[model samples]
Target: MNSRYVGYLFCGLAMIGVGSTVVVSKAIAAGLPPFSATALRFAIAFPVFIVVMRVRRVRWPRLSRRDAWLAIAQAGAGSVGYTVFLISGMKLASAADAGVIAGTLPAVSAAVAMLALGERPAPALIGAIALATTGVLACTIHFDQLSSSRGAGAFTGNALVFAAVVCEALFILLNRKLSRPVDALPLSALMSGIGLAVAIVPACFERPWTLPFDANALLGVVYYALVPTVAGFVLWYAGAARVSGAEAGLMTALVPVSAVALAALVLHEPVTSSQLAGVACVLAAVWLATFGRRLRAPSTAG
Candidate 1:
């Protein structure tokens, strides 16, 4: 029983949770305002995380002043901020479009890595960025004969999702800066708490009871809270313990793929040719950007 193999299994399971988030989040938002929905999701998940930490007897990380601010800022951008944009965008766009748009995240993160971390990218990486951009444009533009309000809303929603990706990318970059890093589980719990705090005031302001409360809404919110945040984080960090960063990056492909399939099946969203093309290009870009170094062949002996 190799630990690394177990890590892979954990990570694979986590990827499924990440993939289904778009459809589930969209469903949750349908019955609640974006702020209220995000607040509810994090609020519900945060206490569960506290319980898990306590039950596991996890040693909490003592944070320095800088680390405290880091947790707050990171939680804002990555957790609360990203969720807000995502739910709002999903309300406007089809789940399938949101799913496809998510594939571009790796490309965004790679660009951030180069700029913020001073990593010099190879030619393939540049090509990957270009291809990703082109793909994004293709999916976003509605050049088809049919022009309607739905098309316009989809465009706006997709753009907002892209913005959410940038916030997430920035959070990733900032997370790299912690000289005294905490263990993933405790850190995640802390971050979730921070997210709850950030969302509370806004959630209070948002008109409650705008959406008719029902059993389905309750189910949707519960699923969003437990499945994606709790289970996904646990599995992802566990797998990350065994997997190389490269392999972890490669695994991200599953999110978009699973998202699209789930959106189509669960939400009954149609997948268009342009979106398929965009997904392909974005996947290719991610592969090239992530693995471009290893893919270079060694020089032959003279």
Candidate 2:
């Protein structure tokens, strides 16, 4: 199998993992507060990541003083900042809207890569960005129903979710610059360890520990920890190692589509016509961004 194909597959799976997280977190939020839920999710996953690193015989690298702090900062922004903003956004906005807004992470990442890292995007990618932006607007900007509370809240939440996406994008861009002298597993473990500490302090104020005791809540926490936090990150980083950051970012579009679909089915959330249109646009953009080059390539002279 081609490495790029494998990278796509891994990234697609990671998106699904990410998509499921919104629903799972929402369910848990019913019983626990948002920050508490976020904290526990990482706390459980942190140990599991550490165990995996040990099993893989991955060793941590000796970082320069500066690199060590940078790694910590990356973890803080990606894991800590992302969770805080996402959970808060979900509280303020519908899960569907949050999911859709989170889809912008690829565009955010592409912009950061261009401005900070001197990476350039192809024309196809630019078209995809336009398509995605249109889709997001179509999905979110319902002029006919502007006065409704749900509609207004969804728009606000989408904005915060976009903010969270930017933080996540910045994390990926920063991590790309870090010299990876350590094994991926151990490095991930260290980052997650730092993230756990960062999350704990704020989580205490939110008091997620007192969430209503129930089977659904337990399952939600377990699923979040195992699937999204641990497995998703591992697959994502593995795919990132083999693919371009733009390619990886494009795959994240699946997260919103999957989340909306799953929410309609499991949570009984309504799937409106406008939302469907938005999904189509975003999908089209993702396809162009990811594969347009191959379709436009000139035939070999041979």
Candidate 3:
């Protein structure tokens, strides 16, 4: 298979990893504080990455001082912010709602790429963004329950999740710029390590160690470390390296769709008709954004 095809395949697999993260994270949050869970996830994943690098004989890139700092900053915003806010959002909102909100991440990433990297989005891409945004709103906002019992916490949680999406978008843009000379594994390891360090201090202060200990909690931590933190990122970087920022952004729309489906199946969340429709809209939008150019063609002259 071609490298680009391989990259796309990796990205699709990464979205599966990203989708499953909500279920795993919700499980972890049941017995662990958000920050503590975040810390443990990265802390365990970092060493595994180091061992993998050693086994593969992958040498770390000699990053310049500026690139190193940029990587650290991106790690702070992306890994730290994303993990913390994601868990917090799940605490305050339904997993279904969190999934819906996360659907907007592709739009956020596209906007960040445009602003930070001057990569202009096509008109079809704009339409895709609109369709995806509509889908998110439909999934998140319960028309029947809007005036009945929707509280401030739900809205606040959604906002936090959106903030996490924006931070992730910025991270993607920064990664593209910094990844040119950097090896993906070492750069990922360094960034994750830095994020782990930042998260650990705050988690310690919050007394994550004192939280109830159980086999499930231990498994949750390990799952996050190995699946989402390590394997998910590897697939993500592989895809991002081969695709344009906009194309990469469009692919992330799958995360929320997959998450919602998984939540319905695994968590017993109700897959309401409206939510299913929203999922369809989001999926259609992603397809349009990704392949609209091919769909539209000019007549050839004989």
Candidate 4:
């Protein structure tokens, strides 16, 4: 079995883990204030993270002064900023919209990889990103209906989600830089700690921090803490190590598809013509991004 395929598998599962959070977060958002909801989930996850690291004998890295600040920034952007923007976006936008917006992460990550990491995208990747970008625009700029609340405020919500995506992209690049030698579990624990530092103060204002007893909400917190926060980070970087950042970016395109599917089934959000068109374009883009190179050359192992 190819390690690249293994990487894709880990990334795909991580994608699903991250994607499905939209519906869960939406449900949780109804019961808890956005900041509280974000804070509560990590509060549970971070302590468990410490336990897991200790149990697994994953020691923290002794980083240089520069790397220490880098880790803090990474945690701030990826964990704290990403969560704040995303949860707030979900509160304002439909889960379906948030799902569709998430598709942009791959394109954003690719661009970030190219500019920051000095990795140039091949022509096929460029084309695929164009298609995905068009799809995202289609989803966001709905010509048919602009009178409704969601439509009127869509920009604010979607923009925030897009900002979250950028933060996540930065996290991906930083993780690629940092985790070449550092283990994912310890790195995640450190990142989560910094995230808690950022979340705690804001969360304090929203406190009493009472989580809901509703099965869905409880499940949201538990799954978020375990699946996405703990396991998703582990699996994502584990896979990322075996593949290119471009490939990893391409892989996260699955986020919106899964998120939209779950949003429809769980949130009962309407599926509009724009959403249909956007999804079609996004799927096509993903197909191209993932396999377009193979049309020109023999597929190589990552």
Better of 2 and 3 by TM-score: 3
Query: In candidate 2, what are the lDDT values of residues 248-289, reduced to their tens digit?
Result: 867877888888888788888888777777777777876776
Model 3's number of clashes is: 0
* Candidate 1 residue spans exceeding 4 A from truth: 1-6, 144-147, 209-211, 298-302
Where's the lowest-lDDT run of ten residues in candidate 3? 143-152
Candidate 1 or 2, higher lDDT? Answer: 1
Clashing pairs in 3: none
Candidate 3 lDDT, 1-302, residue by residue in tens = 88787878888889878887777777776788878888888889989999989998998777788888888888888888888888777766666767766766666677677777788788777877788788777766665655555555666667777777788887877787774567678877887799898898889888966766767767977987898778887889888888776577567777877788789888898877767777777777777777777667778999
Candidate lDDT scores, in order, read: 0.81, 0.77, 0.78, 0.79
Which candidate should be chosen as best, given lDDT against the real structure? Answer: 1
Candidate 1 residue pairs that clash: none
User: TM-scores of all models?
Assistant: 0.91, 0.84, 0.85, 0.82
Considering TM-score, which of the candidate structures 3 and 4 is the better prediction for this target? 3
lDDT of 3 at 246: 59
Model 4 CA lDDT for position 273: 82
Better of 3 and 4 by lDDT: 4
Q: lDDT winner between 1 and 4, please give it.
A: 1
Q: Which candidate number maximizes TM-score?
A: 1
